[model samples]
Target: MAQKNYGKKLLLVVLGSTVMGIGIYLTIIANFGSDPLTMFWIGLSNRLGITIGQANLLVSALMLIVVFFMDRKEIFIGSILNPLVISVTTDFLLRQTITIDSVGLRMMFFILGLLILAFGIAVYSLADFGRGAYEALVFSLNQLFKRSIRIFRILCDISFAIAGILLGAQLSIGPVMAILLMGVSIQFFINHLSRPIYHYLNK
Candidate 1:
């Protein structure tokens, strides 16, 4: 039974990561903007003349260093897999640009990307395997400050968004919406979707 449950969790992690990659790809192709962390990565990529995947890996590594000191327990197989899979998948998809000339279609894609990203986050949380470096940073800060997860999450996003903007990443509607909506959306999914799925899986 333990083995079976572990297998299920592993499966969830892979699926969730893949879904997240798809969401990331969609948002990038939409050309509106991306989530805070991704925005920062893209900004760094542009400035450094590197691939977004490389920027992502570098950022994740730095965040993981902090997590190591703040809360090492959060580092697990999923932690490594999360960044590796997402970066590779995102880079591959990014290379294959799906052009959308219509502004309306781009907006639609952005909205769909946001939804997919939120759902992927919820799936990852439900698996309980481990969190990515950014998620771990948020959780660690929440633990240190004794604040609500939602508050820290929003703050983290805002900070990243600001930094990204300062680093020359375009501040657009998509990023603004992401900053405002991501924490709330993730919480909503945890309450309405992840918990239910967790209960079912454990049962």
Candidate 2:
């Protein structure tokens, strides 16, 4: 029984994490804008002349170090799996993007990307694997500042977005929309989706 549960949990973790990768990929291929963290990763990729997935993993690894020092407990299997899977998934999807000539279609992709991203995040989180490096960073910052995690998250997004823009990453109203909506959207999912999922996993 426990064995069955573990397998299901692992599958959920992988699927949830990979869906997140797909969402990020769609947002990038849309070429409108991306979430700040993604935008920052893209900037790193450009400046470093590596794939965006490579840059994302590199940053996640670096953040893991910081989180390790701040709170070791925050690091979990999901922390490693989350970045590794997403990195691979993103790079794999990179070659799959098609050239879209229609603005309306592009906007639809962008919107779909945002919704998918929120759903992926919520699902991944519900898997009970662990916090990713970025999530850990938010937790650590909240502890350090003794403020709201939501506030720190938004601030982090804004900071990363600015840095990404400075590094020649493109900007659009997209990042703004992401910043404004992501937390709310995640909560919306958690509110609606968590109970059923948690029951299934016995979480």
Candidate 3:
């Protein structure tokens, strides 16, 4: 029974990680601003002359350093898998496809992508495998400040976005609004779906 449960948990982790890739792809397709980490990857790629996937791998490797220092428990197999999967996924999504080009089309894709991303996050969070570096950082800050995780997440995300902008990353109203709105959108999904996912998996 214990082995069975462990296998299920492992499967959930893999699925959750794959869902994360989908969320990232959706973020790109939305043509709005990407999440802070993606913004960082894109910014660094532009500044340093690396591929986006390579930038992501570099960032994820550095994040592993922080994860080891701060909380090893939060850093597990899925942590490695998530970035690797997303990089490949994002690369494929961007290169092999022509995304919506028109302003209205882009806006629609952006909104729909946000919702899909939120759902992916909700599922991933509920899987109870491990938190990504950014997620772990938010959790750590919330614990340290005795503030809400959601608020800390928002603050951290915004700070990263600003940093990306200053570092010569692309910035427009779409991405700026993402910094403001993503937290609320994610919180809504978390609130509505987290419990059900938890119970389903735990059972």
Clashes of 1: 0
Task: Mark the 10 consecutive residues where model 2 has the least summed lDDT.
Answer: 1-10
Q: lDDT of all predictions, in order shown?
A: 0.85, 0.88, 0.71
Query: Quick one: best lDDT, which candidate?
Result: 2
Q: Is candidate 2 or candidate 3 better by TM-score?
A: 2
TM-score of each predicted structure versus truth: 0.90, 0.95, 0.82
Go through the candidates in order and give the clash count of each. Answer: 0, 0, 1
lDDT of 2 by residue, 1-203 (tens): 48777777677778888989999998888888899999999999999999999999999999999989888788888888998999999999997758877989988898888888888889888877779899999998788779999898888899999999998899898898888778888899889988898788875
Instruction: Return the TM-score for candidate 1, rounded to 2 decimals.
Output: 0.90
Pairs in clash, predicted candidate 2:
none
Instruction: Give the worst 10-residue stretch by lDDT in candidate 1.
Output: 194-203
Highest-TM-score candidate: 2
Cα lDDT tens digits for candidate 3, 33-88: 68777787778888899867778888888877776776667776667766777677
Compose the digit string of candidate 1's lDDT tens values, residues 32-100: 988998899989998999888888899999999899999899888788788887888889888885789
Error of 2 at 28 (Å): 0.6
Error of 1 at 150 (Å): 3.2
List runs of model 3 lying over 4 Å from the truth: 142-152
